[model samples]
Target chain A: MSSSELLQFLISGLQSGAIYALVGLGFTLVYASTGIINFAQGEFFMLGGVLAVAGVRIGLPLPLAIVAAVVISAGVGVAMERIALRPRRDSGALVLIIITIGVSMVLKSVARHAFGPNEMALPAFTPGPPVLLLGAAIDRQVLWIWGLTLVAVIGLTLLYTRTRLGRAMRATSLSHDAARLMGIDTAGVVMISFGLAAALGALGGAAVAPLTQTAFDAGARAGLKGFAAAILGGLGNPIAAVLGGLVLGVLESLSVAFISSTYKDAISLVLLLAVLFLRPQGLLGKSGREKV
Target chain B: MKTRRSVLATVLVALLMAAALSGCSGKGNGGSKAGEGGDAPYRIGAIVSLTGSYAGLGTPEQKAIEMEMKRINDAGGINGRQVEVIFEDDATDPAKAQAAVARLLEQENVIAVIGATGTSQTMALRDDIDRAGVPQVSMAGGSVITAEFDKNVFQTPWPNRIVVPFTLRALKDRGLVDVAVISDTGGYGKDGHDLILKGATVAGVKIVADETFNPGDTDMTAQLTKIKSASPDVVLLWNAGKEAAIVAKNIKQLGMAVPLVGSPGNGRREFIEGAGDAADGFRFAAGKILVPEAYGEGTPAFQVAKKFIADYSFAYGVAPDIFAGHAFDAFLVVTDALRRIEGEATPASLRDAIEATDGLVGVGGTFAYSAEDHNGLTEEELVFYRIEGSTWVLDK
Candidate 1:
């Protein structure tokens, strides 16, 4: 490939990987706090995109629509924690995972019925033509994606280090019994994690809605890719997860460029399999001593 | 609280499973033996993707069939046999479709089947349909549905063989010579991809780039960015579902200003609406249903097109899309064959009658079926249209 072409592919990959990072970060946050893989993370992403589209179409300004979408998704996430996760707190991991899958299906069905089967698109945050960068024309929406991703990462990092609730949630995730003895509201912490994770997912969706049209069934693929990103990082590590998402994005783009486009999905998956075989706990995952 | 919570999750899981099962099994319509003037209602089966990725395509087909069923029943059934239609949701799956077709043939005892809406789904059910010796009028856009003709299977709508060539010719004629083709790896998209590869060569167009993405891929920017480097005159996006819409928006985002041409799958309203402003200037070769003026005054196909559009819009409260028109054409052709049957319509007789269908007026086109050529429509039936102001206008 030419230099410009290579630059184009890299930029495109980073843009896509940025969205995956946000989604993967969501997965990591929930898994860290709750110890349950939230399969419905992508659905919250769908909800944000769809609701933003709806909100804009119904006469709200773009910024208001985005806020509305993020808020609504956060509300749904909190409700899911209370209604589904809280009730099933005593259930096994497998059971909880299955329940989340069920919840995902329900959310998808509701979105389908509400929005019909047509995919939707929202106007870009900055609706401008592409800017020529290093002989590669890059879209303005892609800049929005990168900028928002940076903001989310910084905001999340600050939330983790500089906030009382974030510390309490981290303590709860480490050991609920110890957290309880220290007078942390473990249940409330879990809810905050769910809400925060969902908002992040929604924000990612809203950011990318202009580039990738949002449909009712858009979640499954995003969820799978995000899960892959999370696994590529440690399952519950935030910093490595974002890096993992970028690696996957670049790998996928390069696969499409070098190999056949038809085998892009297969090749990325094979790489993921190879990574799993080599490093069971993920690249940056902390290995704990297991009695079993 | 513990037992109650456990019961709640169990109940929710059970309810979800039940919903999933019911979705798969599909609900029957007008299967009542209680209908008058019949010993037993002559069961006709349909398989459409009622709830899945291709649901946008299949739902309209199902709606058209349901509307036709009601019209047929209200008009005192097909030749007084009291038509009972059994609809099955294939969920856009091939294996599911094969099972559904088998169930419809064996359990429902349907003499004829009207669907398996998608190409792969139809092709998957082809074996069972051939074995059962039942007539199947398919709504899929694959040329293989009739090219490698089964004695039992027939096709409605212009397949990629006709659509791709017509589109390529349009591109050639418009001086948009170099083309970038992107298709999903799914069956229908692959079919379009193959056809475009062949059609571009025949139409004397250079393929600047060829790309494919998975069916549910959220972003096509990687592929689109690659295509941007080649700088083709136009882009041909082929897919059965909404992914192509993403391609439409992606092109604009990437500053790729080439005209976006698409397969018949993009002829639907949903595709246009999904693309929103990006839909403008999008071009495709489709049946005259999009621009009925192209049909002219006093043509047999024109009259059928006019009425089908009006009645379907009246029935569904929205303009019937190309897929709906495809199913309507199949319905009309099948029902017309039933009307022409000398005696009772059995699988053999219906197959013969359907094969003998000639000069039949339906929404898609005038299908003149013969034993050798099961796909009755030709390139003459198609018209090129460009989306202007979010509505398709005939490309003069």
Candidate 2:
């Protein structure tokens, strides 16, 4: 590929990669506090976009619609934790995982029925001609994704480093029993983390919806990709998941260009497999320190 | 690891379902099926993609089928035999389609089947349909449905082979020779891709570059960039479902100014809505039903399409999509055949009668089935549409 052509692919990859990062961050946040992989992470993403579309359809402004979507999705996340998991706190990991999958299925079915089977579209945050960067036409939505992602990461960092609640969540993630003994209301932190994770995922979905139209079942793919991103970065390691998402996106775009576009997923799989085999702890993850 | 397991499980179930499907169809024990009694309402079966990937297509198809069923029953019910439709949701999975077809054939004992909206589902269900000695009028528009013709499978929509030439002819008219074809690996996409390759070859057009994308891949900038490098005169995108709209955005995002011509699958309002302004100036060849006036005033095709659009909109409170028209046509074909059967409306009787379908005009245009040809629509039924000012304007 020529330099400009390569830049075009990279820019596109980053745009999508940002989505993966945000979704992955959701997974990381939930896993960090709860010690459970919420399989419905994708469903949360879907709810965000679907709700946003609904919001717009009902005459809300785009910004208000997005806020509504995030809030609703966060409420859904909390509901899932409270109704499904909080009662089954003593259940095995496999059972909890299965319940999350069940939650995802139920959410998908509800969306399918309520929304109908149409791809919902929302106007871009800024509508007009796309900006030209190095001969590559970049949709303005990509900037929204990157800027919001930056804000989210920075805000999350501040929360973790500057806030007592964030420290309590961290301590809980490190050792639930120890944190509880240290008088850290670990359950509240867990609930808060689930809400935060869902809000983050909803934000990602809203950001990407204009670029990629949201389908009722689009959540499964996003969820799987986000899950892959989380795993690639090592579960519970927030920073690494974002980087992992970027790396995965770039790898996918480059593979499509250099090899054949058909095998991009296969290429990603090979790379993911290689990573799992070679560095189980992920790039930025330390041994057992960040494991969920 | 979870994804891997799920993929493996899906494959295994698919293989087992295929095996069961073939066995179930090959058994010519239609007499022993549950719907054997001649006393009940005439049973028709429909297998539609109600949930999965093709749900958008199948939901409308299902709604249309229901509306048609109500109209038929209200209008004295196919020569006094009350028409009862047993609808099954395939979830757009081939395995699910297979299971649904089997249930329809073995349990419901439907005289004929009308859907499973996507090509893959239709293709998967065809073998069992043929084995049960039941005719299936498919709503999906894949060349493979009829190209590899089955005596029992009759397609109602204009297939890829027909739609491709129209778009290609338009491209050639504009002196656009070099073409870049992008196809999704989904059933419709793969079929249309291969046909576009053939269509371009037949038109003496050189393929500058071709790219394939899977269903869920979010970005096409890589492929578009490669196509830009090749500098094709125009790009032909042949993918069904929402992904095609995404391709339009990808084209806009990558600054690839090449004109995009799509298959009939991209003819839906969903595509235009999803792609937003990116859909501006996009063109494709689809059934005249999308633009009824294109068939011209007082023409039989135009009148039928106009009524369908009107009746569908009135009945459902929503503008009917292409798939709805396909389903409407298929339902009409089956019911129309049933009306002509001399004696009992058995599976065999319906099969032979459908095969003899002549000059049957519906939303998908005039369908005429012959001894060898099961797919009835031709290129004449298609019209060229351009997205201008966020509306589908028939290209004069």
**Which number leads on DockQ?**
2
**Model 1 segments more than 4 A misplaced:** A287-292, B1-39
Q: Candidate 2 lDDT, tens digit per residue, B1-396?
A: 453335334433432333243211111112223344565678888888877678788888988988989988898787777788888887777887898899888887788988769999899997798788888988988889999888888998888888888888888887889999999999999998888887777787888999999987677877888888998889999888888998998888777778998888887888899998889989888887777777889988888888888889999898888889999999999999999999788898899999999998887888889988998777888888899988899876
Instruction: Itemize residue pairs with steric clashes in candidate 1.
Output: none
Clashes of 1: 0
lDDT of 2 at A280: 68
What are the lDDT figures for the candidates, one per model? 0.82, 0.83
> Number of clashes in every candidate structure?
0, 1
Please state how well chain A of candidate 2 matches the true chain A, as a TM-score. 0.97
Best by TM-score: 2
Which lDDT tens digits does candidate 1 get at residues B90-168?
8777878888888888877888999878999999988898889999999999888888878888999898888888888
* Candidate 2: pairs in clash: B47-B116
The 10-residue segment of model 1 chain B with minimum total lDDT is B21-30
Q: For candidate 1, write residues A84-135 as lDDT tens digits.
A: 8889887765577677777888888888889877678788888767788987
Query: Lowest-scoring 10 consecutive residues by lDDT in candidate 2 chain A?
Result: A283-292
